[model samples]
Target: MISFEAVAISMQGRTLVRDISLSVMAGEKVVLRGRSGSGKSTLLKAVVGGTPITAGAIRVGSLAVVPENIQRIRQEIAYISQEPGMSRETAAEDLLLPFTFKAHSGKEPTAAQIEAVLDRLLLDPAILRQKSATLSGGEKQRLVIARAILLDKRIFLADEITSALDAESKDAVFSFLLESDHTVLSISHDPEWIGRCSRVFTIENGILREEK
Candidate 1:
C-alpha cells in the first residue's frame, strides 16, 4: 500500500501540489485527472522522489519517500512517463538497462519472459533487436511497461502513458495494468482510463479533490 500524508510540492518558488493527502491499497487502480498544468505529473514525481516535496510524507509500504530511501523505493515501483525516454540505438540495451542498476543487478529476466511480455502488449518479438529511436510512441510505452512487469514490480506510477496509443493498444495496456497485481497510481485525462479506475481524484489549484 501507498500513503501520502499532507504532501505538498513546490518549484521555482511556486507551489504545484499543496497539502494533498491520499492512500492506496494493494491492487487498487487510481487515476489523477485535471486540466493541463494542474500538477498531476508533478504529484506522481513527488511520490517517486523525482520531485522534492516541500512538506509531508509519502510511504510505499514500510519504505518512506525520503532522499535516503528513494533509491530503495524506486527499485520496488515502476514509473512510466508520458514520453518514454529510451536512448537512441540498442533497444535491447535500453530494455535491459534497469538490470544494470545496482538495485536490479543479477536479476535479469529470461529471454522467454521478455518475449511473453512483448507478445502480451501486442509488440513484435523482434523489436528487442531494433533501435530504440525507431519505435513508435505506442511501442515505446508498451516497452516501458513490459520492462517494469518483467522486473516484478508491484507498484506503478504512470503519467499519460496511453495518450499516443491506438485504440487496440490502449485497451491492451489498460487491461494489463488493471488485471495485474500491481497497484497503479496514474495521471491521465482519457475518458476511458478514468472510467476504468476504481478511484479518481481531480487536481485543481494545487489541491486534490476526489470525484464521485
Candidate 2:
C-alpha cells in the first residue's frame, strides 16, 4: 500500500503539485494522467525518494519514505521509468545482470521462470538472443516489465511505460500489468489503458483530483 498525506512538491520557486492526499490500497491498480509537465512524474518519483516533497510525507507499506527507509522501500517497489535505460551486450544478459549485484544475488531467475514471464508478456524467447540495442521500443519495454516481474516486486510505480508500444503490444502489456499481483500506480496518456485502471487521477494547477 502507498499513502500520500498533504504532499506538496516545489522546485526552483515553482510548485508542481500540492495538497496531494491519496491512499492506494494493496492490490489496487491506479492510473494517473495529466498534460506533460503537470508533475505526474514528480509524484511517482517522490515515492522512491527521487524527488523531495516540500510538505507532507509518503509511506510504502509500514515503512516511511525517508533516507533511512529509501533502500528498503526501493526493494519493495519497482519504479519503471518512461524509457528504461537498457545496457547489456544481449537481451539474455540484460535479464541476468541484476542478479550479479550483491543485493540481488541468489535471486537470479531460472529458465522456467524466465520463459513463463516472457510468454505472459507476449515476448518471443528468441529476442533474448538478440543484441539488446537492436530490440524495438516495445520489446525493450516488455523486457523491462519482465525483469520487474521476475523480481517479484510488491508495488509498481510506472511512468508512461507503454508510450512507445503499438496497439497489439500495448494490449499485451496492459493485460500483464492489470492481471499481475502488485499494487500499481501508473502514469499514461493512453485512454484504453486508463480505462482499465481501477481509478484515474489528474493534476492541474498544482492540485490533484480523481477523474470520476
Residue-pair clashes per prediction, in order, are 0, 0
lDDT of 2 by residue, 1-212 (tens): 89999999999989999999999999899998889899999999999999999999999988889999999998888877766778889999997777989999987888999999999889989999999988887888888888888888788888988788887678778888887777899999878778888999998888889988
Q: Where does candidate 2 clash, by residue pair? A: none
Segments in model 1 whose C-alpha atoms lie over 4 Å from true places: none
TM-score of decoy 1:
0.94
Report the Cα lDDT for residue 190, model 2. 79
Q: Best by lDDT, which number?
A: 2
- Output the TM-score of candidate 2: 0.96
Q: In candidate 2, which residue ranges exceed 4 Å CA deviation?
A: none
List TM-score per model, in order.
Answer: 0.94, 0.96
